[model samples]
Target: MSSSITTILTKKSYPPIGHYSQAFRANGHIWVSGQIAADADGNLLKRSMSEQAHQICKNTSKILQAAGSSLEKTVKVTVFATDFSKLPEFNSVYNTYFPQKPPRSAAEVSRLPLDVEVMMEVVALVDPGDEAKL
Candidate 1:
């Protein structure tokens, strides 16, 4: 199977620290990388679990836009949290982004990069005629 792939880049979100694009546009969808509570300068937000969740959503939103998509278009999401006890806080913030309540999964993990408490990745449908943004 052959598919055209476009790397998505944007200054609105934190720069990727690893050898991976922030997102990719292909086959009429956008695949965003796991987003954390990092700022544009790569500094961790150092905020509460809910606050960090807000930052991740904001970052993911920016990445989706850069890839010709939006949070409302998301079809699936996966969340990783180091502290399961904070799930409520994360869910509270997450609900605001996906008011449509897209299918999602959350799991407790041992740890995450940069020692951040939470991380999220998403898959969303690309808006028509917006591939140029990729």
Candidate 2:
């Protein structure tokens, strides 16, 4: 398989805050960056952990869609949180989005961009011929 890389972008999702693409496609996989609880307009949401988790999931879904993939195709996910105590809260909201229970890892971080409560990154399979949709 070719190792050529293609950066993924979409107006439906928030633009990268720094020097990173929202996602990248290569070797039949889509690697999504850690998505914060921000809207398409780049407004950060500082609500409860559950709310932030929901927004993070939404942002991830949008990026995956633009990459010609979906949450259902996700193979792995990594979640970063400011507080590990709120993991249950995060999981409650996360389960609604990833019912298939893909492989996941969660870690407590000292901080996140925008001081958001949660951020999530995912690696998902991109079906053969799916790149044509982008």
Candidate 3:
């Protein structure tokens, strides 16, 4: 790793639900923290599983952008949800955004805050050509 590369863990991108930056950067790669189904205002969105999943995607996209990356460039993601029954609907929303289909890992947990159904973390490389944005 080059010393020029560093980690930036700031709370500006997303509010700290517990203790975490919405995303961080290191070695030219950005590792996004798990973003819940919350809006820019950090308020939990109370909606159906599908809608909540969409919001989580939106939140993740924003965080990646803030780190000089894009959803299309994401290499992998980890999705968290409480209900596997919502998989079909969640996939519908997810596929719409990630048309290229990056690598992903998903899990069905027992619960999420605000009765939310979805959350996600993403990892992407900062395009060397776009280093100015970082």
Better model by lDDT, 1 or 2? 2
Ten residues in sequence with the least summed lDDT for candidate 2: 125-134
- TM-score for candidate 3: 0.86
Model 2 ranges off by over 4 Å: none
- Taking all chains together, the TM-score of candidate 1 against the true structure is 0.93
Between candidates 2 and 3, name the one with more favorable lDDT: 2
* Model 1 score (lDDT): 0.89
Worst 10-residue stretch by lDDT in candidate 3?
5-14
Q: Model 1: clashing residue pairs?
A: none
RMSD of 3: 2.3
lDDT of 2 at 88: 96
Point out the higher-scoring one by TM-score: 1 or 3.
1
> Which residue pairs show collisions in model 3?
none
